[model samples]
Target: MLVSRQTTVHPVAAPPLQVELADAPPPGVWMNSPQGSAGTIGGVGLRLLQALSAAASIAVMASTGVFPSFSAFSYLIAAASLQCLWSLAPAFVYIYALLVKRSLLNLRAMFIFSVGDWITGTLTLSAACASAGVTIVIDNDRKICAGNLCARFMTAIGMAFISWFALAPSFLFNFVLVVTTFASLLAP
Candidate 1:
């Protein structure tokens, strides 16, 4: 006599489910998020304006041929130089991002942009103020204001102010991004 054996089969277990964080932003949201005037075209425009104004400031001051006479003028030159570089590098990145239809508003990038803009803006403002005060003092002395030298100094100061103004919006936008990102991360 032959005996037959019965086999039992066990069911397989399902994979665990993935639970996304409730506070996490949706994918691509940062890409299309509002950045005030720091959006693609706006960012490029602002950066270009900043770069142009800063360069113009430097050119005007240098054209005076006597900028070396005052320490304030030297400081203005250094500040404007920094502002020009800061604005130009971002302008190029904005241009590339625009052409590629990509967003450059990542957390790390925005933080860096915010800090850089703040530092550059502060330098520009301080330099402009110092230069303006020096120019005013020089203008009051008829002996120093004999020519158009003071006028040129005034023009350069104006350009430095303009550059600072152009940078304001970008700094605010990036600063907001950094703050909000951190806030969200810390929130329950």
Candidate 2:
């Protein structure tokens, strides 16, 4: 008897599975920060005030021919000149940030600003105080106001004080920005 053997076949196994994932979120802009827009605008305003006051001080001091005789007055002019330059850059930066509605108060920028503010503020205050002291001596103790020189000197000192006042606030504001930047970096 011839018996036909039954044919057995097994089906092929399925292919291995694969899973697809979504892309990650995009990174934020470098200028963007947690600091508000008002802070930037205020900073610009403060810097502008600083520049203007320092310029005024320089103008008033330089206008008088006798100012060259006094080293303190000359120091005031030099300090105010340097201060104008230092404050102008930050003013422009702040204006740009305000126009873009972003914050430029990053760690590096703020640190630079803080150091600049400290240096300029100290110089400005010292120059103003020295000039004021000299003016007081000439006006009160020495009684050397033959003409209107004393008046002009007093005006210059006043302007220097105003510039210093404006710069002090800007310096404080920079520190606040630094703190904010530090906090942001430490955040999860």
Per-candidate TM-score against the hidden true structure:
0.82, 0.76
- Model 2 over residues 24-95: C-alpha lDDT tens digits? 223443433333222366677788899999999999999887888889999999999999999898888888
Backbone clashes in model 2? 0
- Candidate 1 lDDT over 1-188, as tens digits, reads 99986687788999999998754555745635554334478888889999999999999999998999899999999999999999999888888876866667678888889999999999999999999999988888545775788899999999999999999999988898889888888999
Compute the lDDT for candidate 2: 0.83
lDDT of each: 0.87, 0.83
Q: Provide the global lDDT of candidate 1 against the true structure.
A: 0.87
Who wins the lDDT comparison? 1
Shift of residue 126 alpha carbon in model 1, Å: 0.5
Regions more than 4 Å wrong, model 2: 1-39, 183-188
